[model samples]
Target: MTWLLVIAGAAVGAPLRYLTDRFVQARHDTAFPWGTLTANVLGSLLLGVLTGAATLGDHRLHLLIGTGLCGALTTYSTFSYETLQLVGVGARLYALINLALTLTSGLGAFSVGHAVAQAMST
Candidate 1:
C-alpha cells in the first residue's frame, strides 16, 4: 500500500515537474535554469512542511508527499549538470548565482514551510 501510494504520487509529480520546467524555461531568454531552481525550492518547501506535519500526525503523509512527490519533482542531477554547463560555457557567474540562490532560497522556503506546519499543528 505504501509503495502504491508513493508510485501514484510520483506519477503526478514527474509530469508536473516536466511541464513546469518547460514552461518556466520557455519564458526566460537567459542560460540560468529558473525552472529547475523553482522546482527544487518548491519541492524542498513541500517536503519540509510534510515532514513537520508528520510530527503532528501520520507518517504516511510524509511518505507520500516528501519521499514520493518531492523525490520525483526535484532533480539534483539536472541542477548539477546545468551548473556544470554554465561553467563549461563560461557563464561562471551565472553558475555561482544559480548555486547560491537555489541553496539559500530552498532552505529559506523549507524553513518557512516547516514553521507554517508547526503553527498549524499547534
Candidate 2:
C-alpha cells in the first residue's frame, strides 16, 4: 500500500518535472539551466512542507509526496551535470552562479515551505 502511494506520486511528479523544465528552459536564452534549477527548488519547497506536515503525524503524506514526488521532481543528477558542463565549456562563472543560486534558493524555499506548513497546522 505504501509503495503504491509512492508510485502514484512519482507517476505525476516525473512528467511534471520534465514539463516544467521544458517550459522554463524554453523561455530562457542563456545556458544557465534555469529549468533544472526551478524544478529542484520547487521540489525542495514541497518536500519541506511535506516534512513539516509529517512531523504533525502525517507520515503517509511524507511518503507519497516527499519520498516519491520529490524524489522524481528534483534532479540532482541533472544539476550536477549542467554545472559540470558549464565548467567544461569555459562557463565556469555560470557554473558557480548556478551552484550558489540553487543552494541558497533551494534552502530558502524549503525554509519558507516548512514555515508555511507549520503555521497552517497551528
Candidate 3:
C-alpha cells in the first residue's frame, strides 16, 4: 500500500514539475531554468510542511506528498544541467546567480514551510 501510494504520488509530481517548468520558461524570455528553480523552492517548502505534518502519524500523506510530490517536484538534476548550460554559454555570472538564488530561495522556502506548519499545528 505504501509503495503504491508513493508511485501514484510520483506520477502526479513529475507532470506537475514539467508543467510548472514549461509555464515559467514560457513566461520568461531568458534562457535560465526559472521553472526548475520554482519547482525546487516550492518543493522544499512543501517538504517542510509535510515533515511537520507527519508528526501526526500520516504515513500515506508522507508517501504521497514527500516521496511522490516533492521527490518529483524538486529536481536537482535540472538545476545542475541549467547551471552547466549557463557556464557553457560563457555566462558565468548568470550561472552563479542561478546557483545563489536556488540555494538561498530554496532554504527560505523550507524555513517558511516549517514555520507555517508549526504555526498551523499550534
Candidate 4:
C-alpha cells in the first residue's frame, strides 16, 4: 500500500516538475533556470511540511509526499548541470546567485513550511 501510494505520488510529481520547469522557463528569457529553482524550493517546502505533519503518525503520507512527491519533484542532476553550464558560459555570477539563492530560499521556505505545519498542528 505504501509503495502504491508512493508510485502514485511520483506519477503526479514527475510531470508536474517538468511542466512547472517549462512554464517558468518559458516566462523568463534569462538563463537562470528559474524553473529548476522553483521546483526544488517548492519540493523542499512541501517535504518540510510533510515532515512536520508526520509527527502525527502517518507513514503513508510521508511515503507519498515526502519520499515520493518531493523526491521526484526535485532534481539534483539538473541543478548541478545548470551550475556547470553557467560556469562554462562564464556566467559565474549567475551561477553563484543561483546557488546561494537556491540554498537560502530552500532553507527559508522549508522553515516557513515547518512552522506553518506546527502551528496548524497546535
lDDT of 3 at 87: 99
Stretch of 10 with least lDDT, candidate 1:
54-63
Q: What is the TM-score of each candidate against the true structure?
A: 0.94, 0.94, 0.95, 0.95
Candidate 2 lDDT tens digits, 1-122: 99988998898899989999999999999999999999999999998888767668667877788878999999889999999999999999999999999999999989999899899988
RMSD of each: 1.1, 1.1, 1.0, 1.1
lDDT of 4 by residue, 33-106 (tens): 99999999999899878877768858888888888889999888999999999999999999999999899988
| Candidate 1: stretches off by over 4 Å | none
Q: Runs in model 4 with CA error above 4 Å?
A: none
Ranking by lDDT: 2, 3, 4, 1
* Model 1 score (lDDT): 0.88
Q: What is the C-alpha local distance difference test score of candidate 4?
A: 0.90
Q: Rank the candidates by TM-score, best first.
A: 3, 4, 2, 1
In order, the Cα lDDT scores of the candidates are 0.88, 0.91, 0.91, 0.90
lDDT by residue (tens digit), candidate 1, 11-98: 8889978888999999999999999999998898988788767767676776677778999998899999999999999999999999
Best by lDDT: 2
Model 4 poorest ten-residue lDDT run = 48-57
